[model samples]
Target: MPSKSSSHSWHVFTATQDPHHHHHHHDQLSYELPYTMEICMTELDPVLAGKFFRRSGDEKSGHSAGKEMTELTGINEINKEAFICDFAFDPCGYSMNGMDGELYSTIHVTPEDGYSYASFECAGLVNNDDDDDIVHVLRKVVQIFRPGTMSVSITTCSEYNNEVWRKVAGAVEPLGMKCRSCAVDQFPAIGSVVFQTFTPLRWKNASK
Candidate 1:
């Protein structure tokens, strides 16, 4: 049985008030530029998740093995424009950071038994409903590591009240997921955060 919400067990990543914001007059810093902070944490499918596992006799260094995984798993394709720096843990795990111009994205993987977990973060803006950067990247990340249960959150320093927040669920649901819970919170300083949890539709139905 599976189900989903703000059940944020782990903070994949978060925003911080820049120390350089020496304006003590204000409690929080303002987003001078409009961009979305998109993050996703997923329990990877057990069988497919084994890709991050180390082979029994393979003597490849963690760095070497991780490099292989990055290439083998199609991570390089996620952002052709970004330069990627990736690494693999001693036994089993993967991490990557990509930079494209001023924007950046990161991915971390933890192969915990059948509960292989992966999280991703990207900085981009949802320009229009037609085609945008963040959504496209999110979709590619999802395809790379299909999750049995997934939770996603998006925050923007722009007018995303009815815009980017809704787009989070809309973009992922078509991928065989059912939104279990959604929570909205006003950013302490400015902007808004939309958090949603999900489980595979198949699992949702099974639970019922």
Candidate 2:
């Protein structure tokens, strides 16, 4: 039986630090201005997981398989400048990393029956004026796994905008998952964190 613990989750965080601070004069100056988003999915649909398998005689290389999935999922089009490095595992699994200048995106999958799981993560500038980009990306990620349950966490500086989560919820709920809980907290000087949980309508009905 598939574990009920299986679920998907997302986390996004943004922060800025002074590169020239005297306290860290010896440290290299590195800063990530873009927000980060992580989405995890578990208890994957067997039919969908089958798509990640590599056939015989095919190049037995992870990079090749990763590249194939990247192209198949249209991830390459997400950022024109993004350079991808991917891998495929024996039996069934895939992983990829996308680099676009300073920003990065990564994906990993485990299609096994007992512990099926997948994750998609990316870093990019936040556009408060429009969230369509994120919504589109997330929609695609969810489509890939069609998970039964999911959770999302967003972290950003104290001044971080709250509208992003609303948009995230909006993007996910339409796919049959409904938000069940939302929690907010602070991380001292780091930023604020918001964690939300969701479950598919069918799952909720089953539990009831």
Candidate 3:
């Protein structure tokens, strides 16, 4: 993103015109309070990343592979109580969605050699617990991927905005990940949007 751009950047995330927001499921989320999470991870552990690749060439369908991966990756351990549906792509890749009542959590992985990436997100995950719940969920994801670098973005409705946005660093730093950058912005009905980037302590001095 450039410091000075044409009118393109602002239009990029505007919900009203965003094609994703126009999608059926997203379009239906008219919750009075909605908290959305986005996490991008890169440089995953080779040993763990390799597990996402298919074992038997064409022996299994996508759903079968995904089910194996869900247990293989301990994704089921993330939330023992929730029922999960997972699918693995033919050659390599995995995705799953877990639903708990009306709320949901999802994970996607592209566990390739040089460009491994994974993400986890939950929708309006916690109606309460403010930052505590956010910390718990994200930390679990960090343990799974153990990415060398990661960035997180959180969007929440006005009600929990104040309590949630400030906790990103506190949730991740104890695990040896250091918050490298933080930026914030407000959206029309989305309330607060906070973005933060992190690197492990081995990468740099976490202290200011």
Candidate 4:
């Protein structure tokens, strides 16, 4: 993460509409606290840069191959997990085993509440379907971390094409959060998309 001081030209736009309209069109738009994160160009590893597009067994490197879905969505007492070692990679060069094969990133979810955290990991496997699991897990964290705040930011500085960033935007933006990019210089060949969001002040009534 780049220091907040390292100034770089940032392009701000809404993934949906400008200043999300509240219900009744009368509810005042909440003030969004300012926060920024820097995504370094080096942060994107080769495995995540689309290297494991659609290869069968995890041949790229000796590690885990295929997708696994763990039930982190605490609700009904049900545990479900699946792997796609037999399936071939999809046309997009990712796992064809639904969204599980498409996700290529990881996020550590430590909810504000006492919930055993979980890690979502994928080596080079890139696809669109992976968003739900990622977002679902992150959303839960956001609720636990800053319940009053309705926004969150996913920061990365990995070397990736615009398509990867757009996919990230598509996954995160809908969850009522703003997406931001860092390390613009890294993706000179391809434009970088950065987003901004606010973290609610937990001590709104307390003195500074």
Q: Find the candidate with the highest lDDT and give its number.
A: 3
Please write out the lDDT profile of model 2 over residues 1-208, one tens digit for every residue: 1122434233434354743322212233443233667666778878888778878777657777777877775667666588888787876688888898888888888888878888777877755455666787777777777876666665554444366568778998898877777666655444566666667877678878
CA deviation > 4 Å runs, candidate 4: 1-119, 127-160, 184-208
**TM-score to true structure, per model:** 0.78, 0.77, 0.77, 0.29
lDDT digits (tens) for residues 57-124 of candidate 3: 56988888898888988888777777899999878999999987877889999999898999888875
lDDT of each: 0.69, 0.68, 0.74, 0.31
State each candidate's clash count: 0, 4, 1, 15
| Candidate 4 lDDT score at position 34 | 17
Off by over 4 Å in 1: 1-6, 9-33
Name the candidate, 1 or 4, with the larger lDDT value. Answer: 1
Off by over 4 Å in 3: 1-12, 15-33, 56-58, 127-130, 205-208
Task: Give lDDT: candidate 4, residue 137.
Answer: 42
lDDT of 3 at 10: 16
Residue pairs of candidate 2 with colliding backbone atoms: 8-151, 10-153, 62-87, 62-88
Local error of candidate 1 at residue 120 (angstroms): 0.9
